[model samples]
Target: MTRRLLVSYLTLAALVLLCLELPLGYVYSRAERERATNAAHEEAEAIAGYASLTLAYQHPDELSAQVTACAERIGGRVLVVDPAGALLATSHPLDAADQAALADRPEIAAALRGGNGADVRTSSIGGVNWLSVAVPVRHGATLQGAVRLIVPTGAIADDVHQVWLGLALGGAGVLVAVGTVAATLARWIGRPIRELERAARTLAGGSLTTPASVTTGPPEVRVLAATFNRTAALLEHLLASQSAFAGEASHQLKTPLAALRLRLDNLEPDVPPHLRGHLDAAMTETDRLARMVESLLALARMEETALTPEPVDLDRAAKDRVHAWGALYERHGVRLLLLGAPVGRALAVPGAVEQILDNLLSNSLRVAPAGSTVTVFRRLSGISAELHVADQGPGMTAEQRRRAFDRFWRAPDAPKGGTGLGLSLVQRLTLASGGEAVLLEAPGGGLEAVIRLQTLTPRHPGGFPLPLPRRRPMAGSKAGAGVGAG
Candidate 1:
């Protein structure tokens, strides 16, 4: 954009310089030609004074000498013509063809008819073009003949060429000067806009503190910057308010839910067997409500918290999360397996990797069939690390996976226990940590949740080698687990 702006400014500057310089150059050349012609005319008139006496008295010798002296002074040709348009004397020796042509010249004929005349025509000497001025030599009103002074037009053209060269140099200097100033001005204007673009992108990437600065540029650009700052401020305020409200509402809901669950548990001991099932269902609903509220609270906190990128031991994080859910997996008759070696550190916000893994593992354990393998794995990519949780369960279709990240959106055949916020929370948390979360079809018809995070620079020289962990199936399991090295 700055390049385009600078080019446009230079183009305009060059055009304006051309418009002014071209006509001025032409005018200077024309004036020089006219000055040369007028000077020739004046010289011709002065020579005619001396020639008139010789022509009137029929003295060819004196007239020829005077005409020769005039031609030498002007470095041109001179001729004396009689009233009948016949050449009487010449400045230099000429052939009969040239002498006859001189008498028949247009300006000489006009001069013999008792009139001063001037013309531009080819010279007889070298076939070069010349500006000729002819004046009639009159002795007290009787026209004796004409005296012609001819100067080569090449001299005038030479002078014009020099002047034009100066004009071109001067115009180029002006264009360069103006172009430099225009480029500076373009940078002055474009810098602010470029900065604004960067600030806008940063703000969109969850940094509300970044606002377009109003400084330098035209009045209109400054005004636009001010407007952008105001809009950003408004957006920041609205997001803060929403985050505050979600946190406040979730907290308010959680307290009542916990109190109600405590009261339900207290009533369970006094309840009969027929009503116990209903009470248990009520407790389950309360637990689901509690989980939903916690999820909402987590979402709210994610929006409010600013993520500072940091290096995390993703291998350790995945192993810890999978180990933490080991008891839960045993209760469900599902095999929890940790595959792949421990990967190097991944770049993410604090607690983001843990939260994402926890959500994925919890969801997988809930849906994974009996004796099915629930695998938590780590894979290394170039400058990135991928953490994956694959479950051998009734996985969703492509469309369901796409919409899985939407809050409160569940598949039609989704199990009864989920609040549908697990994947949504995972997605939001991954994005907040400057990572991406995606769902893929695992091998053998299972759903795989993959989180790709940036890898951090190594802390030690040559880096520490990470050893792969062996996969161990659950104790007393009939089916063995599948673990792939990555």
Candidate 2:
């Protein structure tokens, strides 16, 4: 059993043994039978020579006596019969059972028909196997009676036995030895691989420790170990550097942000209205900077928190947004068309669905032309929900569209401009909440923005939870204005 486990090596060794031994065994078996038949023919020819002239005139009994003597010398028996099929052998007394073996045998019939013959077959008497060889005793090629020799099958059997034993014993021993060596080698190779597996898994689990050394193995394993160690150290160093930078950035930014806020507070009420608006714009920029720095600080202190996500119904959130913005849409003389709602709930951070709609609504309200159609479509199919926010306004040119969602870009033709972060912030929130926002050209003209999100159902278990929508600039836009399709 211990040896059998070495199939990795034993399989090859056994195949080699089979390849070498089978043909030799076949050839050796054939030669054994041929040699025996050749010896029988030679002995029969010698006896015929001895009695060639004398047995020609002698009675059949004397001929049988001489032929029997020749066969017995070779550990076999002999038979003689006339052309009339009358048996006349007495040298070895023939039994009634032996008559049947001689009659049906092809070798016997050949000799009777004036031809030499030989065959090896199992014996019927006592079931001992035998080979029969027949030779014609001829006088000038005239039909003389035949001498048939019956040799027991012991010679060929012995040859087969010896050869088979040698092959089996030798083949088995070689296989066993080869198997033992191969198993040892396989284990030696596997040990390092097993160690590498453990080390790799450890690194994946966020360890900065050095990997297990690739000792006593192939050159590849050694090189891989060195590379792994270097990469882990590099990542650790980079993370530490980012932590220090975030700390310095927050301190540096706070002062400028505070000064900008203080400058806004000190604005004199006596200042002209146009100058006051400029001062307000500067304060907004400062506030945006402070917000960015705060976001960076949060990223630096981030941990792998298991945020369990739950389904959110966008329909309810949209209805609420329409209620909130009903007065505004009315004042703009633009209808809010809330089209078909999707069948399933959307997957979002607690208030992400609300926030995303708010941004789309805000952008739509800002750009929508009075008396033009504005459409909001909520669709659900194939385990996902889509929120389409489209408006009939001057469509963005290709170049402008490319930069439409940049942090500070604004369309030159937009009547009511923004700090460009509105759409960008919506994109950021959508991505972090495991959703996507796509902007495309509307059918007639304007923008077709589709928000595809996983629906709240048992479909995705324990996914990320997004932050709730807030009234803040970026956070406020996820809520949509109910721009009805007029």
Candidate 3:
């Protein structure tokens, strides 16, 4: 915009300069030529008087001397020609071969025919241009001869050139001054807009506190900045309130959910043997409720606070998650295989990767049949990192995958004891971390969950060295008490 503004200003300046200078230059040039022509005519008339008197007596020597003296004084050339079309005398000496031709000259011919005339023509001597004037040398009733005065146009041309140079310099200086002012004005107009743009980008990056200063630039720009700052402040306040509400609601609901789960556990024992299966199902439902509440709490916590990214070794995280779920896989007779080479570090928001992996692995382990394989892989390439968990289990259909990320959505034929929030939470957490989560049809007729994130190089040599958490076996542990919800 600033460049465009400057261009517009310069274009106007150039047009104005062109309109003002072009005609003035033409007028000045013509005036200079006319002034030289008038001067040449006056000198020719003066010499013509001397020639007429001298020619009456046919005194060539005396006339030539007077003309030569006048020519030298006025910096011009003078010529005297006779009626018979012969050169009588010249102010300056001329070669005999050059002094003969005179009748064909237009100004001299006119003068010989009893007319006074003037013209601009090139001199024969050295090809320099001259303004020539001719006056008839009359002896009362008869024409004696003609006196011609030729003035070199070098001085007039120099005068016009100086005027042109001055005009050019003045125009250039005006353009430069206008350009400088245009640039300064452009900066003044663009400064506030740049600040607003920067503030917007910072807000997009999850910095809710980025300041948008509103005191500089033009009045309109200042007003715009003020409006933007107010809007951002209001938006931040509203989001903070919403996040607070979600956090408070989730936290408040967890206590009652825990109490309800405990009551279900107590009721499970008192139920009759014939009703034990139904009671166990009821206990399963209660556990699913507990898991749902926990997932909701996690979701609320994530929404409430933005996390700064850090370099995490995805390969190590995958191996650790596999190790943690190892016991459950063995109890279910499912082979948990960690495939592919170790991947480099990835930039992940706090706990985002962990939540994504935990949910995906939990879903994979829940669905994998006996003698089936649940594979966990990590890949690194060109500033990107991906984690994949694939299971040889009943995979989702196209429609199921389409709506899977919607909150609390589940397929009609989905497994029981599920809350239907895992995939949604996974997607939410991944997005929060500035990554993406995708569900794909596994190559071998199973479900594959893939997570992609930006790769980061760790500053330390050990590449974000951290302790791995201990994993308990799934069969006896309370971790896998529910079915896959995603």
Candidate 4:
């Protein structure tokens, strides 16, 4: 922006200088040429007067001396011709042929015909540019001879060239001055805009304390800064209030819910046999309500917190989680397999990969049937490291998948006891880590929860040794519970 502004200022200034200086230069050049022409005519007339007197007295020597003096004074050639256009006296020597050519010249012929003549042209013999002036010598209406003076135009051109140079130098000096002022003005305008951009990024990064400077730059920018400050302050206040409310609500509700569950459990022993089912149903509802409260609080905290990403070993995290959930899957008569080649480290918020994997595995386990396999694996896809948890279970339709990330939204046929916030939490956590969570159709007809994180290059070569190769199924087991290369 600063560079653009400076260029604009320089362009305008250059155009203005051209518009004002071009015509001025042209006029000065014409005036100098006209002044030179008039001075040459005056000198020719004076020499003609002297030539008239000398010619009447028939003194050729006197005329030659006068022509030489005039030539020295004006730095030009001078010639005196008789009325018949024959050269009589000249300051510069001329051969017979040159003298004949000069006498036949148009200006000299015009002067011998009792008329003054002047012309600026290039000489055909030497190819030199000259301004020629001719004045006739008269002794009381009787023409005696003609005087012609020839001046080189190079001197007049030199003067005009100097004027153009001066104009160019003046224009260059003006541009320098304009550029200096433009640079200062550009910085004045651009600095505030840059500050506003930085402040916006900081706000987006979850810092609401810093505000744009509202006192610099133009009034428009200052107003914009002030508006940004007001908006940021309001947002900061609202988020603070929301965090306070979520914290207070969590504290206020946890104890009452716990007491209610305890009360229902106490009534279990005293309740009659037929009412026992009702008591159990009441306890189940209470537990579901507690889960909902916890889910809500977790979501609120996830939204309010900003986490920076760090490198974590993808293969290690996936294998550890699979090993931890092995017992639970075994109890359900299901196999939990960690498949696919080991992808390297990935960038994710601290502890976020674990949470994301936990939620996905928990959801998969809830719907995975007996004798089925719940597979957790990691693979490298382009620049991303993808962690996938695929379950051999009843998967959601496309529409359900699309809405799954909405807070507390659930499929119509979803299993009971779900808070419907797992996917939402997974998505939030994934995004906070500069990654993404997606629900994809598994290859073998099940829902695959995929978490994609930025791949991180290992700091040192051979940092973590590769995991062991695929292992065979344990003896007497219906399904294998082991890691394998895909």
Candidate 5:
């Protein structure tokens, strides 16, 4: 921002300098050239008067000597010609071809015709630029001869160049001054805003105490800082209140629910056989209510916590969870398998991968039928590591999948004991770790829950890594055969 501001100031300064100095330079150059032309013309006219007297008296020697001295004084060449356009004397001697060409020259011809002539042109001989002036000699209305003076234009060009150089130097100096001022101004304006930005990030990162400085920048920025502080304080207060309410509610509800379950169990022994069904139904309802309360509390806790992401070995986590859930799957007569090879580490919030996997596996186990396979796998997709838990159970439709992450939302045909908060928890944990969770249709008919998390290296989409050649037995479990790499 500072660099941009400085460049903007310099650009504006350069434009202003161009507008002011370009015309000034052009006008000065034209004035200098005009002044030189006029001076040469006046001097040429004076020499023409001397030539008139020299020609009328027929003193060629004196005319030659005078022309030579006049050329030396002015650092130019001088020429005197008769009325018929014949060159009589020259300050500088010329070859036969040059002397022959002088009579037909435009300025000299014009002077012999009783008119003054002046022109600036490039010399055909050496490609040098010259300013030439010619004036006729008159002795009381009788033309005796003409005088022509030629000077190089390099001196005039040198003066104009110096002026342009000075203007450029002045513009450069102005840009430097503007850059320094702009940098100072940018810092003055941007410092408080930067502090405000840092404060905002800190608040988002779960630090509610830090506030932007309100005394440093411009008045508008100070006001913004003050407003940010007020807003942050209010948000912090609101979250604190919410957390307190959740904690208090959890404490107040769990004890009563436990006592109610205990009392229902106590009544089961006293109730007769016919009323036992009614008692059992009551207990079931109570259990479902307790699960709902637990789910709600878990969601509340998750919302209040802000966890930073860290690297975890995705392949190792998947294997560990599959091993843990193997016995449960065997008890239901369903196969739990870990597919794919070992993918590298992925970035996720601490304990987030474990919690997300637990919820997904629980959901899959609930919906999976006897003799059906529940597969867990990890693969690399682009720069993300993907973990998929697929179950051979009834899959949801597009509409159900779209709303699956909503809190307490369940499909119409979902299992009876579900609290409908598992998917929601999975999605929340994934997003908090800067990842994504989605329900995709599994191949050969079922639901596939895919979680994508960040990885340090990029990977191309390809076939899954080769599974292990032999099955490895799980510890303290006879269901090892049901849990092999696919």
Candidate 6:
């Protein structure tokens, strides 16, 4: 992780430097060229002025000598060119090879055309970057001739070169500083996360008591750590609860089972018919207690688990489950009716929605009379899509609805045979999906299980859970053991 951070820092700094360097480099190069040309041009203008004075048609010799001396002070050579392109005088080397090289000078030709000119080229005699400039020399209203000057551009090149070197050194220092800071900051930010990751791994490896080492940082990180620590505490408590429950279950369950065994043992000495029946009932009650413990454990497992949820369409999920159980419903003479069409979308965990529907359907199948209707309907209320399962079986009184979502709750009117864990699982799944589940009496005198959920739609995105009916009255009683909401 540290290595990754370093690489990221380095990559970012390089990209910034590359983005900044090229344009500034071009500007520096251009500025250097301009300065060299301007120096030569300034010298040319002075020499041009001196030549104008020499056009005196008198004292031309004196004027020429003055121009040559002025040119020397600035470390350059001057030339006087006639309008006819003839060189009248020059401070250039007068040797044969040097004079012959003067014919190829572009500045000299430009001055003959009555314009100022400047250029940088390798000098044949000096063997260096030579800056040259030419100016149109005039007298009164008539064009007299032109004066040209040459100076070495090595000084300008040296200054620009030094500037470029300084830029290189400065950029290198800045990049290093930036890289150091970036590395430090990335580590500072990433450290707590790394610590948290290690803590989580320890927990995953079955060390739930492992303490998080992240003491402090930003507020958000500290909050996250606090949450982690609290969750760990809760998990430890739950595990302790499970352990305690296991021991209690063993102790409590053995008594009923032992009694049933004793009752059977006594059956060997010519037991009466009624005595046999009582023994059978005792054994049945023991079996029911065992089944209840098992169902309670299943509910506890579902309650303790945390699973990642994905988007699911509750309507589609209900339809598929109903169809799967349709044949069974028909075989039992219960008419399964899907009353309202599915709304096509809901955001829920895939299997969780199906599980919720299964719980509702199972309850409906249990208490529903032969030839009665078990109806499933979808309704849009506010922003929520609701699935309502109504059965013609006896409806719960308001008191029963209030306690219906509680674990191990079996309504008074429900049959006595079922181990109630289905509704508890439904409640857990509803909370997991950011939704709500409730058991209420349908308008048509049967149990109605309503599940409200937020919708996920392209055109209409989501909805809010509305206020449910709060006050519940007492439940009614019935005969025969039936499946009730847990």
Name the top TM-score candidate. 5
Query: Which ten residues in a row are the worst by lDDT in model 1?
Result: 477-486
Write down the lDDT of every candidate, Cα atoms only: 0.79, 0.66, 0.78, 0.82, 0.82, 0.72
Pairs of residues at least 3 apart in sequence or in different chains that clash in candidate 4? none
Collision count for each candidate, in order: 0, 23, 1, 0, 0, 7
Provide the RMSD of all predictions against the true structure, rounded to 1 decimal.
7.4, 8.4, 6.6, 6.2, 5.6, 11.8
lDDT tens digits by residue: candidate 1, 310-421: 8888878887888898998899888888887566887888888887877788777766778778888777655557787887776777777777888887777666667878
What is the per-residue lDDT of model 4 for residues 98-174, given as tens digits with 9 covering 90 to 100? 87787688998888887889999998868878999999899998988789999999989999999999999999999
Please identify which of the two predictions, 2 or 6, would achieve the higher lDDT against the true structure.
Answer: 6
For residues 1-486, what per-residue lDDT tens digits would candidate 3 score against the true structure? 788879999999999999999999999999989888888888888888888888877788998799889889889889888886688778887777666667778888999999989988886769888888988888788888888888899889899999999999999999999999999998888878889899998777556466877788889888888888888888778877877776787788888878887887888768889999987887788788878877777877877666777877787788788899899889989888787666678888766777788888787777666677777776654456778777767777766777778878876666676678898888887787678888877664666777888777533343342322222222322111112345
Which is the better candidate, 1 or 4, if ranked by lDDT? Answer: 4
lDDT of 1: 0.79
Q: Looking at candidate 3, what is the lDDT of residue 399?
A: 65
The estimated TM-scores of all candidates read 0.71, 0.61, 0.80, 0.81, 0.88, 0.51
Model 2 stretches astray by more than 4 angstroms: 1-132, 136-213, 239-255, 268-270, 287-376, 391-444, 453-486
Candidate 3 wrong stretches, greater than 4 Å: 1-15, 41-62, 101-129, 132-148, 205-216, 397-403, 432-434, 457-485
Q: What's the best-to-worst order under TM-score?
A: 5, 4, 3, 1, 2, 6
Model 1 CA lDDT for position 380: 69
Deviation of model 1 at 225, angstroms? 5.9
Model 6, range 378-457, lDDT digits (tens) per residue?
A: 76666677888877666676767777777677876565555576787788788777889877666546777888777765
